[model samples]
Target: MKIFLATGNKNKIEEIKKIFSMENTEILSIKDGIDIPEVVEDGNTFEENSKKKALEIAKFTNMITIADDSGICVEALNGAPGVYSARYAGEHATDEENNKKLIANLQGIENRKAKFVCVITLAKPTGETYSFTGEVHGEIIDEPRGEYGFGYDPYFYIEEYGQTTAEMKDLKNQISHRARALAELKKNIDEILK
Candidate 1:
């Protein structure tokens, strides 16, 4: 079946495709001649935002749509950028801008504890939907470390691998928040395809 991935980010699309590559599914990006309406992500939680995006796009495309709303929650920041991760620096913040802002806000903070949380929502045209969540706990470093991966990957330190999320592309598909979420989604792919 053709699964429409509701996202404007190429990196997200690429990562998601890699995650589901083994499945017999066609993963299409929203950019593939699908001009879906942009949903206002004013929800207070990741699941809410994910559902909004998926349902809206599914309704428009008449196809099963998947959406993910994810962010890094810093313990010291009181999750200041929880739901506002994509636009943390501003409405149209770039990855670099958001990372810089995060680093600036975290300066001199003793606690560097943080975690990445991801919520995935799968929606059919009939309004049927399913939700799943995945999280990866780690700490944030004061400076960037890797060149790959987007958003806060550069500073997201994973103790197990002794590398940032960006530095472990090969391993990320097995342990990152997005990867875990997609893995859970894969477990229920039969229901979604139905």
Candidate 2:
């Protein structure tokens, strides 16, 4: 089973591959001659964005496509940076910029609770689509640490692990938000593949 994934994020591609490698499903990126369209994620919800991207790509390639839209939502900030996590600081800001802004926004604030959220959409060429969501509850730290992971991982601390996502590089496969989402995806794929 070779499914087309509508994304250019190498990190996401790698993560998905690692989880689904045993499923015997070849997850091919849109860059692999699929010519998938760049769908604008103007939706207010993660599910909307995910399904939009998946359906957009499926329309072009006429193949099964998977798309994900994820972000970090801060509880103290009223679930802020939720759908706009990618462009939180600015539309053109870098990951470092976004992280810095997030930290600064919480300066002097006691409650630093937050969570990482992911929504994945799977679409068939015939227009059928399904969605799944994953979330990892945690808090935001004042300082960054570790060299692994990207985005706000350095400051997103997991209560169960007692370490930031970046700091828990060795254990990311079992605790990260993406990992949780992938776990769900793998379960569904297993039933389908079998």
Highest-lDDT candidate: 1
lDDT of 2 by residue, 1-194 (tens): 77887888877787766655764567898456656556899999998999999998888887788889999999889999999998999988889999999999998889999999998888887787887788999999988878888889899888787888988765886766767776787779655434
lDDT tens readout by residue for model 1, 141-176 = 987887777899999998988999989868888898
| Prediction 1 global C-alpha lDDT | 0.90
Worst 10 residues of 1 by lDDT: 22-31
Per-model clash counts, in order, read 0, 0
State the weakest 10-residue window (summed lDDT) of model 2. Answer: 185-194
TM-scores for every predicted model: 0.96, 0.92
List per-prediction Cα lDDT, in the order shown. 0.90, 0.83
